[model samples]
Target: MSTVAQPDLAVLSSPWTLGPLHLSNRVVMGSMHTGLEVRDDGGAAMAAFYRERAAGGVACIVTGGIAVSDEARGGPDFAVFGADGADERFRVAVDAVHDEGGTVLAQLFHAGRYALVQGVTDRHGRPQRAVAPSALPWAAARGVVPEELTGDEVRSTIEDFAAAARSARDIGFDGVEIMASEGYLVNQFQSPLTNHREDEWGGTPERRRRFAVEVVRAVRAAVPDLAVTIRLSGADLMPGSTTDDEVDALVRDLLPLGLDGVSVGIGWHESRTPTVQASVPHGAWVSYAERIARVVRTSDHPDVRVIASNRMTDLRDGETVLRDGLVDAVALARPFLADPDIVARSLGGRFDLVNTCIGCNQACLDRSIVGAPVSCLVNPRAARELAFPARPTRRALRVDVVGGGPAGLAAAVDAARRGHTVTLWEADASLGGQFALAAAIPGKEDYAATVRAAVAELADRGATVHLGRRAAVADLAGSDAVLLALGVVPRPLDVPGADLPHVVSYEQALREGVPAGTVAIVGGGGIGVDTAAFLVESPDEVVRAAEFAERWDVDVARDVLGDVPQRLPAADRVTRPGPEVTVLRRAGKIGQGIGITSRWVAVGRLRDAGVHLVAGVRAYLRIEPGTLWILDEAGVERAVPADHVVVCAGQERAPGAEETGPDGLVANLRAAGVPVAVVGGARDASGVDAVRATSEALEAVRRLAP
Candidate 1:
């Protein structure tokens, strides 16, 4: 609808037909488990969540893993096909999407050995153990050993998929997608690593794929009028697992099974390769989809479209892939969570208005992994659309928000969006305080895109922004309400030689270039780990997919089906020339404060980069001209070579900050009889958490709005 030229992205807005189902565009809202399906609201909350995204302009919505049976449930949060009140719950969601002129697909799901949790119950309130092709322990630490499904049970599970497809059609779903990817029960049967059976279900590669083939054939017959798709694992990215040739053959087999589409996904949950994390290059797995598309195009049924997904957040990339005719559609799951209107906005040539997902996974994936409701770090209202409606307030109040960092920007934009008169002030010349610094880190380029989008949104909402201007009481005289989002200053290190000229704060080191020499980082938190990565990695290597493939040992060409080596060939780290970096922590694990989903991946990258991680430091002995002295946990002293010392110890409240008194602005504003709300680092500077900061800002402004 936008007048601006969007020739490059025209294919994204074009129509496409997947057999019986036709879509208005090539963008699909990929399935993501929001942990909201089990809400007691009879699916009202989940319905609202889907309806909002449906209205935002996705061609179709894929419901998160709907269990075909009680034993198929991945967790307690999954929606079971035959549970009590299940029809009503599913109908509500289906009607909600249909009301918004969007089609919905039910993803039939079954967790095999991956079901490691215990409290999951059947509709009859009986506990069910996990079932797989073979009895395998998913992880030794958790000790979750699943029972092997008998041959009859495997056939019954195939029937379960057909029954679920029938239920989906009765519930008004336009289509059904069998979940055969991500190492689920169907995927488990396709791999020799998990499917050790000598029966019809496993043994040879052809036999190993029989379970998936049968499930598809049954589901297709069960829903002949509806679009039947299969989510296939293009490359498991696991060692000693299913090869690429077997997967290609499986695709060829499914092409004759009357499937309407194939949505390609990569990597098992247990694979050592990074797939969805921030470090992963955007559209890194598109090549796998392209390969499958090649197989599908040359097959008997060319109408079976292929959907590419995995770190795909940009529509331009989607357009390129679609234009090139490699893949028919592109699926983006988290980008929709960041901004539900991504499709509409991009189609309107207002791509700058899109709130890009920085792929932090802090609020979304991290929470979902533990069965918490999923939300976005940049947009917290995602999945809670009903709770935080954007309706206008009774009266528009003049709201003044101080600081232009993540929290301040979020407060200003959200306040304006709710029809309030808003003004924001940033002491720095530009916005994005901590976010700007983070943008400088490798693989975090999207953080800068987020800032640009936020700034544009503020302008679109007609909020006044003053940069390089510090807000004072005089500046806020005309404000009806005040929000203090004054973000943090670096918590100064207190050890000896901390004030040396060679020493720099993490902020300074990120904003400016570090001297080329051995650098010692005095903290092992997220910032410290990021700082180490930034100091050692070249900027060019971050965006280059080939470089990433080489470093992570991904076979981009897919000749061997993108199989990962059992153990990574040793990184030529010792001889690589750059600034030698060392990260030190007083106690606890490295990357302790990082989110669960990203901590291991980030820490592994640091180790791969040859960053020396020193933990359990007894004390910082001293710092000299070219060395940092430290006492070990064993009561021994050691000197670490350091031409430059960067301190990333954490954050603290702004200088001279106080919650009460004439000297404090908060107390002064309260004494002046103006409503005051404090948020972000100004409220609590325990650490620099963008998630907490933005959430606080949104909650405070919404509560304080007139």
Candidate 2:
């Protein structure tokens, strides 16, 4: 009943306003399905889930696909309405958001033919079919005809929208957005391939636009100041679907229907519409938004605002789109997940160190698909905010951390932030270790960005970072305690030809580009073949492309491979350092540990390029400077040409020794001679946990406290 004051500074600085409400910033939190929504009965998560994102300072927080009617929900985990009753859970949500000085919007959706019912007496379940215009299945399905909707059913659907809008308003929501993109029910009706009816709702573009137009008008008429948002898909990428022209026309119609605003996005990562790969630059959708703004300006439409999102993790990208007049506001999803304080940081214009979202979609999307709670990959403290808020710490003892790699850095930063005097020692001059190399490869730059962010977080937390410091047991002598994060060293190939001068490890090959001529790789693991491909695609860009393509052709038999070879991301993003490499192999599968998407792309290119792949060959001897002998799996030795041999075998760690560390050795000094606890890969098979600067370290520190 009382008014809550918004952040005074943010509101005054931002130029955008809707009704009497003023936006402190143009950033809006886009909706994502948090698999975390699953409740005990396999329903949505407790009310606490939505409350945190609001608490985390989202200007406007949207829900994971909440359905207009029960049937539209994909699962019970989706936010669903009960018959004619208010959602009491929203009271807590509204208060939590208001406490944080933010607004909340409910996204009203209908999964349409996509919905399935599994609860309570088998329910209305997919309806033995659906009410699609024609029969068009989406992303995970080939085209199929949906059950046609009767006129009465259509009328009920419209009424359902009205009821849902009223429910949202009654529940203290600032607004509701009609999801009209990404191959959902509404998009299906609006798409030609999916809609084949001759009725008033499906004949021409105008008829097809009728359903959405009616829904918007009904909702707007129901709640005049309810902030009605209709999210539009710029390019659905399906045949007979809406195009830019159709989009322009649809906007002309939908605008006059009393819409509060339109939020625009692209593609169907999970749906049936075509999706562009992550290779597409960040904020690639801005051009489309700019085009939408242009159309609005030239049209005789109402004074409506536009909200656009997609790859908006970078604040500059958000600022650029806003400044360029592409859209009225910028919406983001992964950025806020990566760093909840991004808005506060960006207001400071410290964009470079803002903990960027690399569009990996792994932690954000992949985890949600498997029904896990959504969070950032690098920031483990998110999604568990209620249980573990990022609190200011109490001062503790000084501690030393060895090895500034991923694991070490993660532990160090967390400890330092928890009020420990942390000093991190790296053998190399720079922080990123093997991760740096992995990130340098094509399709791996995201990992590199992750490492950079980690280093920044460590330094910000007051960790003393010592580069070029090859730490040993002596480094921890002066510390209250030591966290030995010694990483693995490269393995040696004791094979006969390893001693030859041309022999190199993949790491060595990276710094000094692989020399011209033939190459032979000894390992068949993930790193081995990946590095080999990069070596073959090295420095001589044009010639390397031809040779790399030609090698695969020659190996697969030139005509068998034909004229087309796959493209390398390296060719587009950066120039490689070496020459056109021809590779010879011992025996192994090429794609060992690459992700489903990365492996498929990488292997397809090499196989298409005709690179000769010989498996099960045993290396015999380096007989000549430019030649080597290899015994076939059949026991006959044959000669192969090799200008260089690279070993790809993995490394070793003696956790065996670390566990049963020699009496009174470095690890035993803690807890009046209680040995260190090491979990994860660092722990022994005994299940002892690793020492954390907070929990584990603080626990140990408590024992010694006065």
Candidate 3:
């Protein structure tokens, strides 16, 4: 295998013209429903969110899907195109993006069968009804069959799209994108499985494609001066849905109807495929863009560009895909959430200083799926950039942060950036606490990037770091304020014979290597699942890497395999006969507190690796020399023989000999006349991960900076 040279940064930052619209660069902020609307004032919060991204150097921004009419609305939080006073309301947001030298495009959408499934109400407090091409129920819609559209109703819906496009152009948008993807209303008309009508609208493939084609034609005719684009699902990835070939054919037909560009979106809301998750390798869906680009290049409209979306988080990967001629532009949604200045940092060649997205969907998509405001786990100021703007401190004061984990590191960096003298103390030789152990897991190496970014930011901001130094109360005597981010200590299992020689804590098992043979993990939470993945050897990492390389036309054996020894020792290292692992949990379900988007990916990998899962355990009987005993949910005693027993029950607050208040060590420190703040897993008895800890620490120290 041969290696491909890295793409030139200049070419990536160069300007490109798509139809009549001219962009500053090739980067596009892909459309995503952030759930940041103000509800009363035509999405004031959503407008401010877009303004921040525009100020950060994104060339073009595609606003989240806006409903064409009240019936087409997904929820009250979504912006409505033809609502009363909507044009005046949205013009402010468009002008804000324009002020920053960026172009904004509105995505006109209709949710169809998947609208307001969770009983979401409108501004009038009335439940929204879903309309579809057929009377089929989407699994995500909770068994609510939509009312099939009549021929007259279909024509009116197409007219509604035309009216929406005209309104977008009137409101000062640079362009309008028809939302014809993601199993929505437009996509339902394109897929044969969803559009089961016997009428002219849905019979053959060509007939099924009529609705989307008509929408494009009508929208283009209604707003002739504005650029008209359509977002298409390159492949639905669902059974009985449109195939790749059909999507290619559909794009070919729609291009002649007047589409300035095509943005390829992979999968649908109902598909079981992993579209955008941490487990999925980057550039996994570039081929979808390649297929659409091929069709566009072959057609008369050769200038029609293709925007490649779906997990193109890194700029290097985006540039590689562009240099390889897969797509004309790269569209990223979550990467901007992680670092709004991703484009600016890349252009400045300060890649090391950039906070890269780790592809963890916890705070972003998972929050949106449950109707919560969307934010980033890595960058907490994503949606609240304007609400919680950073300010410099009035005076420099000495600040001491005890613990070099995520929380402490964040507080120290923030303090130093705010013009304060900051010192961070870590008892261990390293910076990351539990984060280091998490990175050692088979497929979770990306977690290390968070620690690396935090450490680099701390150094760049001139925060003094003290490793292998335990801070006593006397050490913080001269500090104006002290922050206790001292993370958590593992809790020991209280079962009889837990102190046997073969039994070890989850930390020791990962740090000191697990013993060879069968292993039993006594908990099924995030730690236990990760430990099970660690002990049992699996091909998920290798397969995902190879698959990603193949799709992007890169040399895995050279670009990936050559760095295996350094990039991933867990995959290459071998022990005497891999262990057979079993995960036991007291609850009926495993992986509690795991994100809804990536939990299934972890569980699926564990299952494919032959790891056994025993849930709903009533009691832990005992642990013998090389065996452990437990009672099943049915009260039946089960003796499980194992060479090693690993307990991952959870974490507890760090022990302190001093008298503490309800708030623990923080209150105790304040009583001692030290201005103090507490954060991280140590503050919560149940424990918090890096995301929560970092967010809490940043917020707490910001208040103390003044």
Candidate 4:
């Protein structure tokens, strides 16, 4: 709050006005799935979730992918409903937001064959039975595609959208956004791969685009004055499907239909198609936005300002594209989940202190799919913020942050925001510890951005920082609480030949460089794989490495890693099959440590990389020179030529973690002598080395409290 804001450049300043509704910025909160509604009767926390965005200063808040008709219902209460009772109830929710001086709209949709059967019963709740273009399903399985919409079904479907739009308008929605993107029924029809029908509804470009066109036309006709927007993809980004040229033509045809704006997006690129999602960096698809926005900018369509939306979590990232004129507005889905009041803070000049969305797909996608309200892992108060705001303290407590990483940084931000005087001690000049390394991975750079934003927020929020200082237990003096986030140390194996010069550790490769050649890697844990991944091209290149790193981030969801990692795949890397890799796993299964899905993927890559796996082994033989001799399960010594051996057992406790934070959350807080907390890998450790160290650190800070 020290400096004045540089104009809240979010969706509020979108620059275009929709009738009496001029958004405060260009940060539109695009519609997403949050199974918050209790029933199709239109009840529960769904309204509050949407209202939270409005209260948070979103320029325009759109509904989740609601089912427009019974047949279109995917699962449970998708916001879309046709019953008069549902619209009336939705109106009450709209009034709550309107009363707050905010604008809102609903996105009307039909799941097509993608519709779910819902609950354990998997009732095809509302079945739109039928093949899309070629019976190729849109999303992950829920079984039994409804019979393709008959000619009768087609006419009824068009009416469904219009009727839904009319229903939305009557329910007091400020406007409506046609769901023509994200591989829904509309995108299915727009895509030639899915829509092979020739009867006026398919085959040719125009024919294929007919369904979306009709929806837009119908919605526009229904809401002549209400701002009617279209969510359209620039290109499908799929193989054997729509290309950029096809995208150009699609826009050319849709432009004359009188849309107030377009929410330009990318890939619902079928499972087989390369799509941009969680693993992808923020704004990776901006080109798609710019391309489509420009193509539609000709003539009166210029008024159809293009709104670029995605998991644009960081504000600066959003501003970068907006400043370039490539997009008029930026849509933030996950970030809002992390910090609902982000708008107020950004406007108030605390942009650096903004709690960011780490692009963890756990809350947004996973929870929704499993039938729960969407939320974030890091930010506990996502959708339910109204009920929780860091509670006021009865008295002041001093706080000390032992390490600077995601959890540590998060703790510092909240403690400071909660009015605690905090000091964070980082051993390295760089604040982030192992976290920086995690983010340094090629496809995971976005996590680095999250850390960067978190660090910036820490500085802005007034947490005093100590760089180049590693605190020992003795250092935990004179504080009220200590958060020992001083992360984990790599566990090194003690075998006779483990210390050769050619053998490198994953941490070293990340911090240094891998010599380019036929380097044989020796361990296959996440770190070992990280080392291999850094030096080699493909998992298959170090064929057995997939076995080592397969379990990384395994706790994210469904006994699997984060879902974001699944959706956010990077461009495949091609590796020459020379660096004959060797992995030694005690667990015979090459993919055991990793998730079923990720393991298959990684093992396949490792196979492609030609990595040789030697599991159920225990010893390494060799002190010098050229070869790595391994003891196989069969008690045979198999030797593989090695230029490098990277040891990647997971991280061990810091030099001392146990004797640290002993008593509990409070005792530990008092030990640090400052308000602090540990997170990530550090939080997982509990022993004399880790826990004792944690207790001592906490006591150090507790002494500082008044």
Q: Pick the candidate with the highest TM-score.
A: 1
- Superior candidate under lDDT, 1 versus 2: 1
Would you list the C-alpha lDDT of every candidate in the order shown?
0.84, 0.60, 0.78, 0.62
**lDDT per residue, candidate 2, 1-706, as tens digits?**
0012222334323756654356667778788776444343222232454555565545777766777775566545466655322265555566667677778788888877665432311134433334455655554433533567777777788888888888888878888888888777777778786778898889888888888888888888877777888888876755556777988888888876777678887754443321322323345456566666777777676468787777556555555555545468878877666666667666665544566565545555655644456665555544655545445456577766666655566567666666778888787878766667666554345556657766776767777889987655555566765665555545777766578789888888765656666766666555765676666444323233244334422111121122334533334333322333334445555554443334454555455545555566666555346666677667787766667777666665423225335532345445344233332223331221121212332333223221
- Give lDDT: candidate 3, residue 203: 89
Q: Model 1, residue 439: what's the lDDT?
A: 89
Which runs in model 1 stand beyond 4 Å of their true positions? 1-6, 541-544, 557-579
How many residue pairs clash per model?
A: 0, 17, 0, 103
Query: TM-scores across all candidates?
Result: 0.95, 0.76, 0.92, 0.76
**Candidate 2: C-alpha lDDT:** 0.60
RMSD of 4: 8.6
> Candidate 3, residues 633-699: lDDT per residue as tens digits?
9999998767899999988866531246553545556667878877877678584676788788878
Task: Evaluate model 4: give its TM-score.
Answer: 0.76
- For model 1, residues 294-346, the per-residue Cα lDDT tens digits are 99898888878999888878787677667777689999999999999999998
Give per-residue CA lDDT, model 4, range 194-272, as digits (tens): 7878788887888887777887888788878788888887666566666678777877777788777888877662443
Can you rank all candidates by TM-score, best first? 1, 3, 2, 4
**Model 4 residue 414 CA deviation in Å:** 1.7
Better of 2 and 4 by TM-score: 2
Highest-scoring model, lDDT: 1
